[model samples]
Structures are given as C-alpha cells and as structure tokens.
Target: MTEAINDWMAGFEARIADLQRKSADLQQNIAASGATATSPDGGVRVTVGPTGALQDLQLAPSTTRYPPAELAGIIMRVAAEAQREAAHRVAQAFAPVAEGTDAMRMLQEFLPPPPEHVSDAPVDGLPGVDDIDEPPQPSTPPPSPPPPAAPPRPPRRPSTQDDDDFEQPW
Candidate 1:
C-alpha cells in the first residue's frame, strides 16, 4: 500500500509540472503575438496586439488629401482589419491547448467573422465573356410611338352684353 501511494504521488507531481510548463508557453505565445493591416490605398496602417487592442497607427503623407471624415473612416477600417488578424493569430496560438474543448468555441465567438468577397461571375458553371462563341445581342423592345396630338379647341366668342346693363340703383 505504501508503494502504491508513492507511485500515485509521483504521477500527480509530474502532471502539475506539465501543466505549469504549458501555462508558461501559452502566456509567452500570447505576449509575442500581434498583427498589422494597411488600407487598400496604402494611406493608413494599423497594428493590434493578441487581445485585439490597438498598438500603433501610421498614416502616409498623401493622406492629407482626404478630408478629416474620410481619413477617420479609413483609419477605422484599417484598425478593424488589424484587430481581426490579431484575433486569428491569438486563436491559432491557443488552438493546441483549446482542442476538443469549449474554449475554442468561446474564442471564436470573440473574434469577427471573415470578410465576404463579391464576384461578378455568373452563379452557374456557364462560360464567361471570353469563352462565348458569339456576342449576345441586346433584346430591347421597340419604342412605342408618341401619343397622337389632341384636336384643336374652338375659339371663345366675345360677350355681347355691355357694362351699362349691369349697373344697379343705389
């Protein structure tokens, strides 16, 4: 019985040490993580830390051409992009520890969804413009003729009554 208790105690100590090491690794990974993004026009850049906090911002000299409102909008967009990237990095860093656990779901809930892209192509598997055998002719309907002009109206005849006929006694 004494040997069995010793073996159990050793296993418990090893588990505790392993847990501590993993905790340290996780903390290091989170501390070292950050992400950056720039505006499409390259006028603004933003950086965010692992917890999605803004860390830095940079603006190009040419950004002065934009109005204050426009500049502010661009900065907001860039910052949001950077935060999303940072969130993704943090999620990846925690993935190993969070696997097969509810922590992954909770982490995903805190992150923003990926951006959606718009495509001009047709939904079906039809050939595109370049693959067409012949250009499609526009099927515009014929324009209706203008409405017929209204008939002319007869002229009004002058009044035959005189102003003296309308006079009344006081």
Candidate 2:
C-alpha cells in the first residue's frame, strides 16, 4: 500500500511540474500576444495580463444613455463574461500538458459515476412506496356531464310599439 501511495505521489508531483511549466508558457504567450476579450454585444472590451489580471477596460458610447446604476450593472455583466472567456482561453492553452495527467483524472472524479448495474424489479412495489399513501386522485368525474345543460329558449318576435308613428308611402 505504501508503494502504491508513493507511486501516486510521484505521478502527482510530475503533473504539478508539468502544470507549472505550462503556466510559464501561458504567461509568456499572454505577455507577447496581449489577449483581449469582448462582450457579445460589443459594448465592453477587457484586456488581461499574462497572469490573468484585469489590465484595462473600454466601454461603448451607447452605454451613456443608461442610468448610472444600470450602466454599472451592464459594465459588470460584460466584464464578467469577458473574464470567463479569458479564463477559458488560459485553460485551453494549458490543455496540452494537462490533458492526461493525474490532475485531470482527479477533476473527472467530480462527475457522477455510471450505475454499476440496473435492477429489473418494478418501481410500484419499491420499499419506500408504502410510506407515501396518498396516490394522485382523478379530476371530479368530468364535472358530472355538465348537469345535462339547460333547454334552449325560443326567439322573440319584434314589437309593434314603434309602428304607430310610421306612414305607408306606397
């Protein structure tokens, strides 16, 4: 067991060294290339240092129309999006050295493992089903066929109350 642990530790140390070297490369690339990320709406621009620090920000002219609080919100949202993109780029750049290492395998542990086996037993008779005695009830018998509806009323004829004032011009 101790030998197994030592082996794992050795692999872990190698992975760390590789990550450090990759980080150095990433820093150099960032310094040379000066990565810039922009918001989807093009309303904000963010510049980052090689070590992933915010270097600068540029705001669009249309942002002035918004109220002070709203404008601050917009800027914050845009900056957050740009920062995420920058971090993604950094991760992607480090992928070459980090892909197959123990560190990557450790990350994979966070995901739920696949089921070892599937049972053929029915769900209705499961052990906990008895605890929940209140099964769903059906709707009220289709409203009792709507009480056979009321009989239709007869149409009324027009009244002769206004005919007395009319003149026949035939």
TM-scores for all candidates: the values are 0.63, 0.41
Cα lDDT over the full model 2: 0.58
lDDT per model, in order?
Answer: 0.75, 0.58
Residue 50 of model 2: what lDDT? 40
**Regions more than 4 Å wrong, model 2:** 1-27, 30-35, 105-170
Write down the TM-score for model 1: 0.63
Per-residue lDDT tens digits of candidate 2, residues 53-164? Answer: 6789998885555567655655565455555555555555555656888875664454333323322112323222223454433335434445677899999988867666
Best by lDDT: 1
Model 1: per-residue Cα lDDT over 24-141, one tens digit each: 8878888877889987667788988887788899999967766676678668767877888888888877876777689898988888987643221122333233335644444577
Q: Kindly report which residue stretches of model 1 are placed more than 4 angstroms away from their true locations once superposed.
A: 116-170
Number of colliding residue pairs in model 2:
0
Clashes of each: 0, 0
Worst 10 residues of 1 by lDDT: 118-127
Highest TM-score model number: 1
Error of 2 at 151 (Å): 65
